[model samples]
Target: MGKIIIYEHANFRGVSREITSDISNLGRLDFNDIISSVKVIGQPWVAYEHINYSGRLMVLEEGEHNYVGRSMNDTISSLQMITEDLHNPQITLYEHPNYQGKSRVIREATNLAAGFDNDIMSSHKVQRGAWLLCEHSDGSGIQYIAREKDNLPHYSAIYLNDKLSFLRPLRPGQQLCPGGIALSSPQPCSWHPGCHPAPRGRNSNSRSPAEMGRIILYEHTNFQGLSKEFTSDIANLRDADWNDLASSAKVIGQPWVLYEHSNYGGRFLVLEEGDHSFFGTKLNNKISSLQMITEDLSNPEITLYEHANYQGKSRVVREATNLAAGHDNDIMTSHKVQRGVWLLCEHSDGSGIQYLARERENLPNYKAINFNDKLSFLRPLRAGRSY
Candidate 1:
C-alpha cells in the first residue's frame, strides 16, 4: 500500500489531505486545482491533470516533494497508487490504431530509434507495469501515462496519436521487503526457505523462467544459420568454434553483454531480455565473448574517464547523477564498471541515446561505439532480487 499527502499551499502550508487509495475525481473533495505540494510514502503514486485519471500525468516516488513542479502544481485532478511490480516492465507499441500494422515490444526505458521516433506510435498495450510516453528523445515535452492494458486501440482519443518519441517504466522507491525481496503480491515460494516442494523429475515440456539468464546466438541475422545457446559466461567464444559468428541473438531472464574481443575485452553491447533480429553494423558477426549479468544490481558503481583508454581526469559515481551539473558532462570517453549494471544517457534526465554498461567491464574507448564525449546522465539498473 501507499500514501500521499497533498497540500493546498507550497512548502506544506495551508490545508491538506491524505490519500490512501485511488481518487477518480478530486472535485468531489473540493481539492481540484488546489494542491501545491505533496509527500509520498511506502510506494509510488501518480497525479493526473484531469478527472478519472486522464490527461497529463506525473509520477511521485516515495519522498517529500515540497512543490509539485510547474506542470502539475495546483492542477492535479486525480490520483492513483502504482501497485505493479516495476522490476521488469514491458510494453508493445503499434504503428497503426486498433493494434494494427508493425509493432515492437520494449522491456526497458528507451529513446525511440530512428524508425520508431517522430510521431509513429498510434496504439499500445502495456503487458507489465506502467509506462510514460513522451514527445521528445530526452523525455520532455507532451507526455502520456500508460498502465497495464490488454489493448489501447487509439491514441488519437487522448490527442497523442503518432506523437510519442521516448518511453520508460515508472520506477518505484528503493524499498525492499524482508531479505531484500521487492514487494510483489503472492511472493514466490523460492524466496522463503522451507516452503519449497520436493523436487520432481524433469519434464522436457517444462519451460524455464526468464530469470535463468538464457541466451541464444545466431550466425546470421533473423536467427538464421548456425546457432548456439548459452546459460553462462563465455570467456572466449573461439574455444567453442563460434568466434565472430554471432549476427543476432535472443535473451531470456537477465540481460547479457557481448564483447568484441576474447576474455571480455574491447567494445561491448548490452542486450536486454528480448529477441534481437540484428546486432547492428558495428557488432554483427563481431562478438568474441559474452557475460551474463546475474548479480545484485541495487548498488552500482562506475568510473568515467575524460579521455580514451582510461586516461585524463576521472569521476567515480555510485548513484544516478547528471554530469552536466558537475564537470564531467559531454567529456567521458571511457568508463570502468565496478559493480552492478548501469545505463549511460546523452541527456541530463536519463534520456536520449542510451547505452548499457555492465559490471567488471573496462571499456577503454567510446569512439568505437560512436558515443565518444556524449554522456550526460547515468543510473544503475534495478532488476530487483532473483527468486
Candidate 2:
C-alpha cells in the first residue's frame, strides 16, 4: 500500500496527517478545505474535490508536491489509491455517444493521428487501468481522467465532449498492491523521516532519461554564466526568475519549444536534442516560456503559400526537397505547419539562414522575420537529427 502525507501549508509545512488507506471525506478528520501540500509514497493516489470520490480530481504521483496546483490546493475532500497494474493499460474511444459509431482501441500514449484526431470523440470505455485525456496535443488545456469502466456513454457529463486531442495511461507507482489492502514486504522509507516504512519495489525515479526529458538553460552564450535545469514544462519562466535570461541551452532527450511570451504565446523556436551555444539574434535573451514536444515526429506535413495570408498558389511538402526543382523556389511568403517541426532554408542545399516552424496556423508574412521570397530548401525535423 502507498501513503500520503497532507500538510496544512505549502512546501510541506505546518500540521500534517498521514493516510495509508482510502478516505471518502476529509471532513471526518477536520482536514477539509485545508490541505495545501502533499507527499506520496509507493502507488499513485487520486485527490477529489468533493467527498465519496466525486467532482474534480487530480492524480498525485510519487514524490512531494510543494503546492498541489491552483485548482487542487486546499480543495481536495476525498482520496483514493490506484492499485491496478498499469503496465499495459488500454482504452477504447467512440465517435458517438453510448459506445456507438466508429471506435479505436488505444494502448499507448499518443497525439491522436489522422482521421480520428481533433475533437471527434464523444464517448469512451476504459477496459483496464487509468487514462488521462487532454484537450491539446502537447497535453495543455483542459483534461479528464478515466479509470476502469465498461462504458462511459457520454462526454457531456464530464464537460469534455469533442475536446480531447491527447491520451496517455497513468502508470502505476512502485510497490502497488494487487487490490488495495494487501501490503507488500516493508522497506526503509528514505523520502521522509518518521513516516511509515515503504514497500520494496522499483524506484519511482528509475525512468530513463528520454522519458524524463531534460533541458538546461544558460544565461550567457557558449554555455557560460548562470544556468538551470528543467524536466517539465514552464508556462512562465518569470516565476522561476529565469524569464528572457536564456542565451543558450542544452536539450538532453526530447525537443523543446521556446516561446517569446508567457503562457506559450508569440513566436517560438524548436530546439532538438543537442547542445546550443547560442540562440541567435531572434531569441537571445528573449524567451519567456518553454514546452516539450512529446509526440512522434515520424510523419511531418506542411503547406506553403505563394502569397501572404495563404493566398495564391500552394503546395504540400512532406519530405526534404529543393523547391527550385519544382519551380517553386523564391516564391513562398507564408505557410501553415499542419504537423511536426520544419526547417525552412534560404539555399537549395539547406545552407545559409534558416527558420524553424512548428505546428500552428498560417504564418501570414515571412517578411516579419526577413525570410520573404528567400525559401529554397525545406524539410521536417526528425528525432536524432541534431539542430
Candidate 3:
C-alpha cells in the first residue's frame, strides 16, 4: 500500500498515481515539494468532488496547505491509501448468428469485469457468466435476453436461472465466489425508500414489467377477434362463427362491427364489437351501418368493442358510440392512448358495416334504429348520404 497521489499541473488539471514506498523518488519528496515533474498516463484527471477517495497524509508548501492534486511533481507515501483495480479484461457478448425473433443484442456475452456503465453500483455488475438483458426499439418492448457460455461474460442469455433469482451477476475470480451474495464493508444499497422488491414466480407481484418475458406476436390465421396483422384464417364463418369467436376473445357478440386495421401500426387485422345493430347504414365501414339481421326477440343481447391506435386527428364517426365491455376491442385503450379521439370498434374485413345497439324496428327490410333514444335515425357517414 502506498500514496494515491493527485499531481496537479500548471493547467489546473490533476492526475492520480500510485507510488510504492520502495520507489526512491517518492521517498525523496516530502509534503512541501512540487510534485508534478513525474510522468503518468491514462485518464488520471478528475474534479475533486468526483473522487471517492479521502483522508491521506497532508504536507504544505510555501506557507499554504497544498491542494495536493495540481501543479507539483513531488510524491507522498502511505501504507493505508489502498484501492482495488476492479476492472478485469471485459469480454463483450454479441448476438448469435442463429438467433431468431426480434431479439437485439443489448450487451455482448463478454466479461465486463470492469463493471457496470454505472460504476457506483458495481456490486450488481453483470457477472462473468451472468445474464445480459436487452430491449428492442419497437414499442412492442423487449425481445429477450440471451445467455453466454460458461464464464463467457457479456453476450450471455438472461433465462439461465429462474427469475426468482435475479440474472445480473458479477465477474469471476473476485473476492466473492459464485452463489450467495457478497459481504462488503461499505454499504452499497442502503435501506432506502421507494426501493420496491422485484416480483418473482408466476404468483409474485414483485416483478418489474421490464424483467418480464418477451411475447412475440405470431400471426393469427383465424384473425376473427384480432387486428389486421393477425388477419387470415377465418373461412367458413357464417353466423355461428361469431359466437365462437366472442367466447374465445371474451366479448359479447350480438351487434358487432367488423374492421380491417388501417395501414398504420404494422397493418393489424381486427374486428370491433357494438351494442346496436342498426342506427345508420345498410352497409358501411362505420358502426352506424348495422341493419336488422334477426326477426325474433327474447334473444341474448349483443355488444361490440373496437381497437384504435394512438395517432390521427381524433373525431367522432358514424359508428362512434362509447359503450361498455369492449375495451379489449381496442388495445389502444389498454395502453392509455384514447385521450384525443373517438375510436370506433369494427370487424375483420376492414368493414365498419354495423354494431349491436338498436335492433331494427322494421325487420323485413333491415333498417337501423334511432339513437339518442330519438325518433330520428342517423345514417352512416357514407360518400353521399344524409340521415
lDDT of 2 by residue, 1-387 (tens): 688999999999999999988999999989998999999987788899999998777889888999998888889999988877777899999989998998888886655521234688889999898887887765667777788874789989777788887778886766634433224436433443344544467876465645547789987899986567888899988656577778999987768889999998877777888899999898898998998876556788999999999899999999988997879999999999888778888899876767778777579999986889999999887664422
Between which residue pairs do clashes occur in model 2? none
Each prediction's TM-score against the native?
A: 0.46, 0.51, 0.17
Q: How much lDDT does each candidate structure score?
A: 0.81, 0.81, 0.24
RMSD of 3: 24.0
lDDT of 3 at 241: 13
Residues 128-179 of candidate 1: C-alpha lDDT, one tens digit per residue: 9889888875577788778876478999876778888777787766444443
Winner on TM-score between 2 and 3 is 2
Clashes of 3: 82
Q: Give the TM-score of candidate 2.
A: 0.51
Task: Evaluate model 1: give its TM-score.
Answer: 0.46
Residue 57 C-alpha lDDT in model 2: 79
Of candidate 2, the 10-residue stretch with the lowest lDDT total is 176-185
Q: Candidates 1 and 3: which is better by lDDT? A: 1
